[model samples]
Target: MSEVQKYTIADVASRNGRGGAPVWLIYKDSVYDVTSYIPEHPGGDVILEEAGKDCTKAFDDVDHSSDAVTVLKKYKIGEIVEEEKKYDANGKKKKRVVAAAPENSGNRSCMNKITCGLLG
Candidate 1:
C-alpha cells in the first residue's frame, strides 16, 4: 500500500493572520501559488480569503475538470527527484544532495522552459 503524506492545514490557517509563510495548494505532487489570485477568485471571497491559510477543504469542494488538473500539473513547485544507481560524467549523476529551492523564491524553471515557449 502507498502511504499518504499529511500536512497540517489547520495549523497553517491559524498562522496565516499572523503573517506566516504562504501556504501552497498541493495536489497530485503539484503545488499551486494561490496567493495572488485570492482576491480575484471567481468562487467568491470566503473560499479564497484564506490565501496564506490552509484551504484544502475549500479547494477540494470546488468543481474542476481533468483538463484543469493537467494544467495545474504544469505549475508544479519543486523538481521531481529520481533515484540514481551510479555516477556518470556525460549524464553527470552525482552523490551530492541538492536541496530543493524554497517556494516564493521567484525562480521557476518551468516558467522559462515550458510556459514561456507555449504562451508566447
Candidate 2:
C-alpha cells in the first residue's frame, strides 16, 4: 500500500495564510504545533520561512527527537486551536471546537451516542 502523504508547515501556511490550519508538524509520530509559537521562534524569519514547509532539519538542528514527529491527528489539537480562535480570529467563517466534557462526567461515549441519536 502507498504511504499516506503528510503536509509540511509551508504547505499548510500557504494553503490558508499565516495561521491557516492549526497543523501538527509530525516528524516521526509525536505532534508539535509550531503555529502559536511562530513569533517566539528562535530562528526568526528562517523558522517563519520554513512555515508551511517541513522543518525536519530545523527540528533536528534544534535537537528535537525524530520519533516525536509522528501520530499527528487534527482532532487531538482542540486546545491550541481554541486558544487561537479567542484572539486574532481569522477566516471567512470560523468553526468552533466543542470542548470535551470533564473527567467527572460519566459515560461520555454513551452520552454522546444518546445525544447524537436524539439530535438525529
Report the number of the highest-lDDT candidate. 1
How well does candidate 2 score on lDDT at residue 85? Answer: 29
TM-score of each: 0.34, 0.31
lDDT of 1: 0.46
Largest TM-score belongs to which candidate? 1
Candidate 1, residues 1-120, lDDT tens digits: the string is 654333343433443433545545534322355555445545644534544443334555776667656655554443112232123434333468789967775666766769777988
In model 2, the runs with Cα more than 4 Å from the true position are 1-24, 29-31, 64-120
Residue range 30-98, candidate 2, lDDT tens digits: 235556554554555454544443444566676744343332233223222332322233323344678
Worst ten-residue run, lDDT, model 2? 78-87
Off by over 4 Å in 1: 1-20, 47-60, 66-75, 79-120
Please list the C-alpha lDDT of all candidates, in the order they appear.
0.46, 0.45
